[model samples]
Target chain A: MEKKFEIKDLITVGVFSALYSIVMFAVACLGFIPILMVFMPLLCPLVAAIPLMLYFSKIKHFGMITITGTLIGILMFIIGHPYPILIFCIGAGLLTEVVLKMGNYQSIKHCVAASAVFSLWFLGMVIAFFFSFRDAYFASILDGYGQEYVDAMKSYTPTWVFFAMIIMCLVGGTVGGLLGAKVLKKHFRKAGMA
Target chain B: MEIGVCSNKNGAFIKLDPRSKLLLLITISIIMIGARTVEVEGVLRLICAAIPLVLLLSIREYKASFIYLLLLGSALICEKHIAPYTHGICNIVLMMICGLITRFVAGYMMGWYTVKSTSVSEFITAMERMHCPSFISIPMSVMFRYFPTLSEEYKSINDAKRMRELGHPFSQPLTYIEYILVPLMMSTVRIADELSAASLSKGLSAGEKRTHICEVSIRPLDVFAITGTMVMFVLFLVY
Candidate 1:
């Protein structure tokens, strides 16, 4: 079967890729405390807003989404955020895709949960890569500064960080769904994608 | 569609095969990075870095190359006087920026080149021709195409952040993180699935040998560029 390639599809890809990269660049630019990025708000919400996955659910695009993720990975990798950033992205992306599938793309709960799980994987990767143990080696670079770095470590806990991350992810996902639902629903209506 | 970043250069720089460019970037990057201390090694790296700057100028990509040198120069300046005052932030920022600039330029050039000549099918085929594992090539090809997609997503995420932050008096870093990650992750999962399905529907079988739409050849221009790269690279090293 000779399938016609739509110029519009390419346009769509271009738009989304650009949007995705911008989101990553903005949030990822600001350094965090732990250091968690204070700009996480700018990033997660926008990403969650785009209904790319929902569109995928109806269509299941082949290389489009993965390619976007890969570009983001390369951009950051080029920027030098250590190895875990890339690892987390790939790991978390896969996890989210799996979770989305688990829900059969029929339930909003599954989508939200999937995004949360996806982000958690990245958080976990960060902890494992930087710290020796939970709360034991929280501030990675400060470990060398000894008491100076360690002195301030007392302001938080691993559980707190985890909970914070989960909340953030939840908010992010919810917002993402809200934003994505409209565009993606329209996208799905204009079908033959999957 | 540009295959590599060099296309933007538009001169002799763009004439070289992407493979050569990759080789040059890798070799130069390793040597520069290997210069352990700023004294003997750092000085050498600075000199070596100049060669690329000149090539960039000749290619008319002076701006990009200048940005690269600026990073190295700033690092040198910072390491000399501001090291202790800034608590090493200057050095760290400089090194990372330098690293980022080099990779970004190299990737850009290669990406430009790939798009100009090779079709997606050709790229996949070439990997197979080179004896690359399907597992590896499939992912690489996927990643290559994905680059633009990711960049796009980042753009939207950035805009959303801008909107929210601007809404408030002083947007903190925490606020940014809270919003960005959610959308970014959401978009990622969405597209990945669609792309996977689309590629599948296209019957993108990895096992089959593919065809090449663009002929890849090493021209005299490539030789000249590489030779120029070597001489300058050596001059920088020994200087």
Candidate 2:
């Protein structure tokens, strides 16, 4: 019989996705600090890698990762992120799925690679700054934050910084992936769960 | 009908259809986020904030509503009074915290209310009525039901850690985190396996559509709430 996403696989996806989002939310709380906000793209992926790698190791199905990504996007929206994030996340999920497929879903190396790729979705959280609504967004920021704070934010996040953040995300993702794999081996593998 | 009455027991004053709660959630979230980008009037913001607060109060979630009011009051006060005095980093931190609270509180409260008020079966049935695929609805329902369970599992793990006399997290961060996460993952995965087995035996994976004993209908109050929210949303856009 052809393989399909049984209830078992879907439930597993839901559970792990919840775990990933909780970890992501914990890291996201750091964004309240303006300086830390700049590094969120890196920090989120680094912190979230353990859960993502563990989730990847358990799943042999094709669309499960994509579903997890979409679900996270929806959760982000629920928590007040822009709708454009959904597009970015879905794209990242698809890319991660493709990367995992290259290794036939079993290789530890591909799992690490996929983890790095999956972390790219953090880009969605900041893409709003590059949108045409920048002026309106900044205006809102001005109203909320003082003029000095807005100026500081503008200086902190120039156009190049967006690309720099992307690079940071990839690097952080790779490092996090390696760390996550080690953690998985030391713990889950020993338990025979992964 | 039995399940409907049972679920409505919590919110006896106003029984919103699950669809209305969903609509209320979307409206509140959009207004909250868009209010920052666009020049939404203060009156509209107040109304948006009030919608959830009033609903929460009506539902008898006194503690949550009280907390929401307290946070909103403090955020507004900090923005108006306290944030002006601070300089440099202090000013930035205070303003950012206030901005986040003011920006997100309404939407967050609305989401909390929706999730708290609606049961899993009702949510799935509502999605089914809206023609969402089972793939989306099933996992969403499971995710919603699992959050509290996750927190409960974490507490138990923490209790175990304390009993084991694990080193303080600050002293040995890696070991502490590993101890917490490894057991949490193991327990969560084990729970998922058991949940799946239980659900499968309950016919959750049955190819046919499932029926709910809970009644979900768009009553007059639902119409009132939906139209009220839509009007405010349109006003926020136009003005």
Best by DockQ: 2
Docking verdict class for candidate 2: medium
Top lDDT hit:
2
Give the alpha-carbon lDDT of every model.
0.50, 0.82
The two-chain DockQ for each candidate, comma-separated, is 0.07, 0.60
Model 2 lDDT per residue over A5-100, tens place: 798888998899888888788788878867788888888888788878888888888888888888888878877787888988899999998999
Interface RMSD of each: 8.9, 1.9
- Give the least accurate 10-residue stretch of model 2 chain A, judged by summed lDDT: A128-137
**Poorest stretch of ten by lDDT in candidate 1 chain B:** B5-14
Tens-digit lDDT track for model 1 on A1-194? 12443322333444454444554444454433324453364355446345444534442333334444544454445333444556666666666666666676567667656545544433532353224453433343231222332343333344456556657766775666555654455544455332
**How many Å off is the CA of B142 in candidate 2?**
1.1
